[model samples]
Target: MTSTDKYIEMKVPAFILTGLLCGLLLQPVAAQTGPAHNRPNIILIMSDDMGYSDLGCYGSEISTPNLDSLAMTGLRYTRFHNMGHCCPSRAALMTGLYPHQTGLGWMTGTNFHLPGFTDELNEHCVTIAEVLKTAGYATLMAGKWHLSHNIHAGGPQHDWPLQRGFEKFYGILTGAGNYYDPASLCRDNTLITPLNDPEYHPQHFYFTNAITDNAVRFMQERPKDKPFFMYVAYTTAHWPMQAPEEAIEKYKGKYDAGWDVLRRQRFEREKALGVIDKDATLSPSDTHPWAEEKDKAAMARRMETYAAMITIMDQGIGKIVDELKKEGIFDNTVIVFLQDNGGNAEGTGFGGPEGETRPVVPKNAAALKPLGKDEVQYAINPPVTRDGKRVMQGKNVMAGPADTYLAYLKPWGNLSNTPFRKYKNFVYEGGVATPLIIHWPDGIKAERGAVRTQSGHEIDLMPTIAQLAGAKYPSVYKGNEITPVSGISLIPTFEDKPLPPERAIYWSHQANRAMLMGKWKIVSGGILNGPYGKWKTYVSLPWQLYDMENDRSEMRDLSAEHPDIVKKMAAMWDKWAHSTNVYPMPWKEVKPPLRPDYMSTPWEYPDF
Candidate 1:
């Protein structure tokens, strides 16, 4: 374990402690398994549908002082990759394996029933919670737990957080939804609507605050003798952009300058902050000019809502930090913050308010009856509000209200992922790249605010936590043969030792592929279909290569000049795809299991 694990270790010898003292120390100490070891408490916080440069530390104009403070004294990683989307990213992060190995190559909603595409987390893989809990860490999870396929109340709960090793769980079963009256919202194993949840009744029921509050409650009531591990997954800044009106008002007129100017501004700030290469050129964008926009006011208002969502999350992070400090565990707690994926460019309610399921409502409808305390909210996108207001969306309908549902759209997403090329679900830097900030004052051997240029991936998290807790990763768990971890511990980086080069990093989501080997990177995203004939698939696309040392933004394609290198990397990617159960993708043969339809259309950029 790094320098921080000593905080919670109870190593008082029986011979040394007198009669009554022995009982007091050993009573709870016996709860933990394994040898006496220093195990730092870990808090993993993840934001949904955010961008690489969205944090103030990462050069955004948004107010994120809490996250900025963490970055100020923490170690920042410049070349970390997340899986292009939430499902696979979370899978890789939790299991220390590629997504396909966890039977989550696709999303939880899709049950291809194939090797790589099972509906829920498979038996072969163990979660970070399961591993840490075995070593006596009290595991608590707050926020989205979208790893299970059967989210319906009466459906099977075999794969929910409680079964997966979390001692306490308070969050949604499905992914993104309304913050005020979220669907699939639950406490522990029982599903309940926010309006009637008996245990928690804040002045106002906001999801972000609720998530952090429950986490704080867990910490407060936790057995102080044992170390703890928490996963705080916040669904902020995702589609159906909603926040407290006052929070949204904080960023009013923030984006009146539009995406082009905003993107450029963030680029300059990132360079100045040393997060990006000072000499790196900002990647170009396809956003409309601010002056010529027909709905400049609406776009600005939408961005304000998005910024507010992030700002609120930042404030929640501050609350989490404050609690840690109050509990006197701040120095020994490892606080990690990263986004699930880059900014989403889905065309959610982009055009009009006519998109609601119940398009028309009585102008002044009677108030809807409140559900029973134990009744569950089943729909992620409900037809009406808890009080009978019809849920509406569009350019005319303002965002940041309970009755409104919409995303900020692509132009703002372009600004969110400034100096990088695409949005979520693609393998380009903009799609998969996210800022990773880690704070462990007692354990970090590197200088404060140090930036590491070495490349890392979500898979690295599992092994890193394993080393921190000194927990042994199982070879065979519950009779199922477990897959070996594909990641190495990241602790070495925190201790000032640079990671050796030459390990290949692989990624494939919806046929968008990338492989990074040393300074060279090969990516192919032109087609959703894997390369046909040669890659043994029905689709084809040429591989584009880049020298990452120079073109971190992926602006320069060196494929034609380095065909040999491209061919070699493509061959490696093909072999990996086959071995990792990425072959026989369900898209070609198996019909996709009915998945919840959430967005209108995915934002597709030019294919040049």
Candidate 2:
């Protein structure tokens, strides 16, 4: 009997049946028994809270030679997008579905017992790791996993990496934390303290390097019988911008020109690099003039530290690439580098204070104290640490040292996003757009250093990876029916083909909504005042239309010019929101006041 017929005749459990059927009918072109060269390994690298232009190749002043080199040898997508926030982007990336479809339309915190805000990845969706594992690929993950809620309070471990099909996992379970002493770290479901725990001697640890080290170790120990899928997520360039002293010192005076000048320079460089069109106008600075700032030195220091963090992350990426080369897998490995979202504008242009606290040491302990030492906190209303250490929170302290916790904030965020408007948490281009670099020497035969303007989103990643790995999207997983993949494989784009003509994308977060059909887009509800101040209903908001092909920066609104088109797109968005479980914005159930600050920490939101 044929293999398909034999499998059909077998009385296997429904869950096992899907995998067995996949094995028999959808065998990868590069079978496990076949030559090793046929199946390529996959590595997906994501940066947290990174702007669209934060990488060297993508027009940043930051030193990202490793990433730039990868882009040079591969493909760069100028119009790639994330879900405009961390958890939502990650949910879409992992499950190939809209965030709401995977129970993560909002951040993973209190579920509020809502359909889309469950604070955990629902079983109905299958992760890329889960799907790839069924195709004989070894799945591994390292770094921030913000898909689960209340991790420290025994949150659903079943939604953690290992339970989602990653055979091995390491890194933080929460959305944001201090890089030096990250909380809620784990290895294969076992909670472990950071390497810099006080008990450990020479308590010097950086989370970026640690994540990369674990990733390389996973590669070295992975079984050679099967190809591997590695998801390396780094929380660098996020809040609590901490870096090693030496690294921070490298860019001490890099941003003295301030954000206004820096933004212009970055815009010019992007134009020169062809990443942005020559006519792309810079968005007016929403921040104060650098020259008028009284604290010029401190502002420069903040940008310097932010640059240092990104550079250090880049250094870690170099180590990962070197490890791949060492394993003789560089040529056959697909490396995708992207960011979770646009530059964050939390904590205003300058970060807010964490609150008052007893000094851990003398106020003038040192000009440059070691990171994770002072235990200074910011934007934490309660002003308490995990160990119940009462600490100060706020911008009273200068950023950079471990003792201080602060974000680069809005001015720098505006610069990081370059010519794009707005910052993270909005549906604007600057908020959702992110740089995507794909490198595969053996697989991608397209022209090197090619830039594609085709629009794509995080949801496309899983389906694209599945296509390249010859993995099947199982209809059933673990006896539960699985949501069919919602993304189209980007394989055709690798051959310089355009995205499908009927393609449509939708996004909604905190009542900020957008829908894109081909080159036309309609966006609404990002005003930060009045009843619409935060997460309000989208029905009362006016929808603005734009022809993305002509104005990707969303400079001109076409709503008045094309009322019928706007109406149609708005209807489509409502349909998508209803179908994807994105209706009933969190505000409808709970009208919590707008966050006092923009920092993404759980404590910042009273509702959490």
- Which one is best on TM-score? 1
| Candidate 1 lDDT, 1-608, residue by residue in tens | 21112211224321122223212322222222234344689999989999999999999999999999888898999889899898888888888888998999978877877889887889999999999899889999999988888888777888999999899999998877888888899888988887678789999999999999999999999888889999999998788889999998878878887887888889999998888999887887756677888877777888999999899899999999999999788988999988888888887776444333323233433323444556677766665777766777666567888877788888888888878888898888889999999999877767778898888888878877877776777878888888777776677678667654555678988768898867888887744434331222323356898888899889889999867677766777787788788886876422223344875544434373
Q: After superposition, how far is residue 46 of candidate 2 from its true place, in Å?
A: 0.5
Best by lDDT: 1
Question: lDDT per prediction?
Answer: 0.80, 0.77
- In model 2, what are the clashing residue pairs, if there are any? 353-393, 353-394, 354-378, 354-379, 354-393, 354-394, 355-393, 371-402, 372-402
* Candidate 1, position 134, lDDT: 90
Question: For model 1, what is the error of residue 345's alpha carbon versus the real structure, in angstroms, after optimal superposition?
Answer: 0.8
Off by more than 4 A, model 2: 1-37, 153-155, 195-203, 348-393, 526-540, 589-608
**Model 1 score (lDDT):** 0.80
